[model samples]
Target: MVSIEMIVAARARLRGHARRTPLLSSPFLDEIAGRRLFIKAECLQHTGSFKFRGGWSAVSALEPEVRARGVIAFSSGNHAQGVALAARLHGVPSVIIMPDDAPKLKISNTRALGAEVVLYDRAKEDRDAIGARLSEERRLTLIKPFDEPQVIAGQGTTGLEIAEQAEEEGVSSAEVLAPCGGGGLTSGIALALEARTPGFRVRPCEPEGFDDTTRSLASGRIERNATLSGSICDAIITPQPGNITFPILKRLAGPGIVVTDEEALRAMALAFTRLKIVVEPGGAVALAAALFHGEQLQEDAAIVVTSGGNVDDEMFARALALRG
Candidate 1:
């Protein structure tokens, strides 16, 4: 479990690096939900996602010798860019292993950031096996996408900032929501909120077809390892919650709420049209939950962390059409 001290340390370590992303009020969502809504726009973060918080935190926490050895990670998109950018900041080399079906924009962005990219087949080949072999052969330190304590601690800083921003804005006990893929961001937010405010409720927003966190919370075990289907939310396409993130989420999160692909696409379009922000399908899941799952939220003041904004042009048009 991550402690408040760890979050504080992470904040200090990432002080100059990570953006103090804004918490913008959404009157549109507020009118729809009949409650105030604040968005912590991590999509505006460096590398265009909140993943940089954990990525930089993990890399910065490493010992000098480990940094000297460099790092390796497996990710489909946002985390890949995070690791690549973080490694570059620390003057360390990084190797990223991504699924062959990973987004082309993400692959190109990772390469642009000076990281070596290796593609593997997620269906036919095991990415973990390939990563392990590479780690052993190259003597590189493995930096997992979401399963490490330092990574969780780093992610917790976002929650810490949110709580502080809420307090500054004179709102107490707001409902905090985040997109859950491998559970890193959700678990970290819950831990930080529980420690800092103790009155706030942190919830996970998941894609309907890929609601592993929701199903796992309902079943009392992390068992949904099936591949996601029929969704444009590729950034959050995970088979299951991360082993390290599941237990923490179970202990700290309120509940997992699932939103459909249509809802997510609508939310993405709404964000882009109204807020003038470009949010990807996965990043808009929290907003979808707010719009579609309002009954579960009741009259609570809500805050959704818009996680990323990387989307292809064709997909963006499709999402906009879904809104219509």
Candidate 2:
């Protein structure tokens, strides 16, 4: 479904549009990790997550006439904001279907970006079904959160940055840790690292109970999460890995990693104090694994993506409290 060429093409499309988010390192974090730690702080990206890259890629790939027809998408939050913002930028109309339980900040931000917001009960209703109905009724093009070739290629650009940035920093080989929802980010990074920076690895990181990608990798097939409504990492509570994304991840990624909400919160706290940045729970998972599950990672410098920073005030406070 994707390749390094696609990632390169997507990166060209994203230049001057997407921020080439810089990699950050900290002495404190290094002490905690006992290895060199570089954070690709995509939390600083537009729309507060890497989703913006894929969203823009999908929107930008649309034919001019088709772009005028507008687009629809389903996201718990990050992708919603991304598509909304991308549509606004391209002067395309957008409608986003989001769960009622998604973070209020994310919902509000999405709407503020000018997309119509549709709410659904995550437990009682199927977001995709609702989105499909809307798409059919409105004739809006549907841009999925992940699972699309353009989306995966767009997300892969982050890995391109990691490889180039690491080399600039004089690092030879590294294992990458990225937050996993449906494996878009992980798989995309895997493809890029495999091509541009041989020997570099991508590992999927997820919340404990919702670690479907982890289990799926173990069994060599896709598996569903028993419950998705729980994790504090709301941004990445996808039920299973995407069909297109799974194969790439299965081939290039290392063993999956899991961290608890507590660990995620603590990692968020650490990011704030050590990195001087705010990170949401889902965004902190990779860093959480780096900080708390180090034993499981490859014996090399770790490059972790603190994927986003769109948390609600209350939750951000709770994450900060863990610091004390």
| Winner by lDDT | 2
Residues 277-309 of candidate 2: C-alpha lDDT, one tens digit per residue = 889999999999999999997766999999999
For residues 186-205, write the lDDT of model 1, one tens digit per residue.
88888889888888888899
Q: How many backbone collisions does model 2 have? A: 0
**In model 1, which regions exceed 4 Å deviation?**
none
List runs of model 2 lying over 4 Å from the truth: none
Please estimate how well model 2 matches the true structure, expressed as its whole-model Cα lDDT: 0.92
Give the lDDT of residue 305 in candidate 2: 97
Show the lowest summed lDDT stretch of 10 residues, model 2.
Answer: 291-300
lDDT values of the candidates?
0.88, 0.92
